[model samples]
Target: MNAHQSLSRRRMLGLAALGAAALAGQSTITAAPRAAAAPAAGVSDGTFVPAVVVGTGYGAAVSALRLGEAGVSTLMLEMGRLWNQPGPDGDVFCGMLQPDKRSSWFKTRTEAPLGSFLWLDVANRDIEPYAGVLDRVNFDQMSVYVGRGVGGGSLVNGGMAVTPRRSYFEEVLPQVDADEMYSTYFPRANSGLRVKNIDRGWFEQTEWYTYARVGREQAAKAGVGTTFVPNVYDWDYMRREADGTVPRSALTAEVIYGNNHGKVSLDKSYLAAALGTGNVVIETLHQVKTIRQRSDGTYLLTVEQKDDGGKLLATKEISCRHLFLGAGSLGSTELLLRARETGTLANLNSEIGGGWGPNGNVMTARANHVWNPTGARQSSIPALGIDDWDNPDHPVFAEIAPMPAGLETWVSLYLAITKNPERGTFVYDAAKDRADLRWTREQNAPAVAAAKSLFDRINKANTTMYRYDLFGKRLKAFADDFCYHPLGGCVLGRATDNYGRVTGYKNLYVTDGSLIPGSIGVNPFVTITALAERNVERIIREDVKDSHRD
Candidate 1:
């Protein structure tokens, strides 16, 4: 047999042994467990699976793991390639300090949402073609920043795993079983994601957290409550890095590009456990282009395989009895929108691309006094946030972000999550064969106004001013054109049923951040994961229970 076949056989034998050992009440097994089907490099010809999950983010990871635990085999498809392997520089990922071609997708120039430094071109660079980790999908009025690799946003985010308040969650998804979500799925998702808070003792004294402390003090002066945000980053490792006992990740300015260490991304948690179940497989570098249903109720997907240079190597078709859409807000919406417009799935409801929002994202900077140094050593992992969501007029939950330039810039950056009621729609552009986000520049005004209302109070109380040098062209405060937390697009109860069952479709579901109606008032990954956990449990119990009966 060939090496691939031999490896697969060995993996199956090892899994069989592990199962036997478990049944016999043994403590452990000898062989390291592997995924049910080995992770494929690309989409092979004539591939078929019992189930397929598109994208490997929080929603996809949770569904894959839960389905695997239920003894259902699944194949995950990711647009970007795997990032766990080291490159020629002996590092798995490029750092934000000097981002190379690996920082973006096929673009010749990097397009960081924070595009300019002091309104100059010092932040971006031109590079050759490569499959980068972060992708900035641009629209006419807004740009959405999303992670592209196997771990999705987890690969590029600040590891801020936050759950929205109960009232806010209920407001966004009222039909959802909030009781089950709070009592069961929320806690289950948190434990599964390995979310933790930073050490209070270390956060107070560490030089790395001085930026956070500066914001905390100013927020306190403004009489706003500051709360410690939980994250997926390992706080123990961060403490060791502070003491010089371990290698540094957050201290080394590793946030946007990718963390080399100290961050526990989805690849290390849910995705990892999913693979250990021996019933889940992931196919990287495979982008699903279209999805259509067969007459027999199976789903047919057309996927394209691409090389690092953005060359399309091949196109292949895969069929699955069940399909899960975990591609984030934009991706999942675009796919269904295109399919609906092209008559591939004409029965799809018109709400397929409606109810999109930017999660009320607004980034701003506050200039601290010269006497108040915000510290040169700033931790990329943010732990403190100014929680003013209870304010009836201007509700905002602003996280004190880090500006880890390795020098004291005397600026405090904050990414405020507001409660903007505006929603956008994705319209199919037949000329471009893609969906366009209908969010206009004017719609973002309310978001910026809300964010400014909260930050202005803190700035005025602390004798601070809005920093003009951070954003483009001496802008005083609030960059409202881009978002890191893109939510909605395929809203629950509209595009799909309350349980994420896409209208007029069987054995197909939407299990991602796209299910949220518009605003959630916090970092959305935790809510997305919890909602997926709740939906998948019902799906398995009601939809796929009989098929999995072996």
Candidate 2:
């Protein structure tokens, strides 16, 4: 048999055994409840219980784990399956893992299509209407990526763990005490995600290393001063590369789609722990379509459950005393916006869909002629960054993350994080059951100019360092596109209060990328996770207490 067939057979056997073991102590396992399944007509007479989290992405996972730890019972509802098996695509490799197109585990049910590196397939889709007047600017020019599964984007994201610049954090989330967040939330997220730097030893042998080394050298010569940063991955796997036990091919640059190794997604971290708590239960393949608040302050959720082929199986209503919206920015915003626009929840304020931004993210690639082989593979870890962000003269918050070496024909790729003030709008589409997002340049003139000018300088500097071309002579080629790091939409101060409490809605909270008020000038997952941690903790300590008194 071919390698894939053999691997599939072995995996099936292992899963069967695991199923037997799990069923040994329990009765027959019924197919999990479908969100579309009908529910009993009457309101639940059962006592209003503690909060139930209705999503299992990063925000939901962290919130569920923290709530469970705090002795609160939570039921997490996920629309996608848990990624426990090696993805169907044999492309599952180690360091800098990328998405395997062959993986049966990957789902394309929603309208938002994704490509390799979890980048949005903008060419295939049109911009949503509420995205404002920018819809006419050719959304095909933009690329935004999102993940849908047990761990959400954490599963498909490049495992770069960067703490936002301290100054930027204070400015945007000014209500949050930076000292407390840095000391408490940041470290907590890093530890939970198993964040670490790429060991310099193992990366030396890989071709992907050549790209990063050349990029860093070119940036430094240009006076950008790039450095490696920490990542959420297993250091031991990297050590094995050093020992030659694992091949450089094993660390294939397949990040963004999904990684077989190297980085730790939520499935292995927060979700795993939450599952172990026994107090927390997760139901996958359940999509929440709408939410209604009862007179007694309880939440009734209408969900649609789908079969493997994406057919609607059933619909059901679930009631919970507390509802946590941890669906990523797109998913959560879509749900809220639909509910508001459709008059399903008309009481929501005008701020429900305001303050959207793409975190000013742009993806630009630079080429280097002489491949700097020294520690190239090990340097895949982004240990360096540029401080051009905070300069009042430039006023752009930006950083560069290392791209895997050897993937491209030339030297390296760096994801430039600029403070692009460009804002996008997220509107609900009931017919499509998705968010129509539109990003425009007319509203983002400064951000657009800044992105072009910064890359122009980098391109000019690369000429001095090496003999390769940069950006293909396209001055503003990359701005109209987007990276996977989407932020805002349901911003903190706008859609919800400072503590993530939605205005005019009690006992309902939002915790996810949706809570970010605006662009954070960095990869947003770490910030999202940290913010969820802080918000959940506050709810347990403050909101729950207030509820008790009431």
**Candidate with maximal TM-score:** 1
lDDT of each: 0.84, 0.60
How close is each model in CA RMSD to the real structure? 6.2, 8.6
Clashes of 1: 0
True lDDT of residue 264, candidate 2: 68
List where candidate 2 sits over 4 angstroms from the true fold. 1-49, 87-141, 200-208, 246-250, 370-383, 395-408, 430-433, 443-445, 464-476, 545-550
The residue-by-residue lDDT of candidate 2 on 270-376, one tens digit each, is 76666544345565667788877777778888877665346677787777777888987776777788878877677887766566776766554444554443333
Q: Which residue pairs collide, candidate 1? A: none
Superposition error at 221 for model 2 (Å)? 1.2
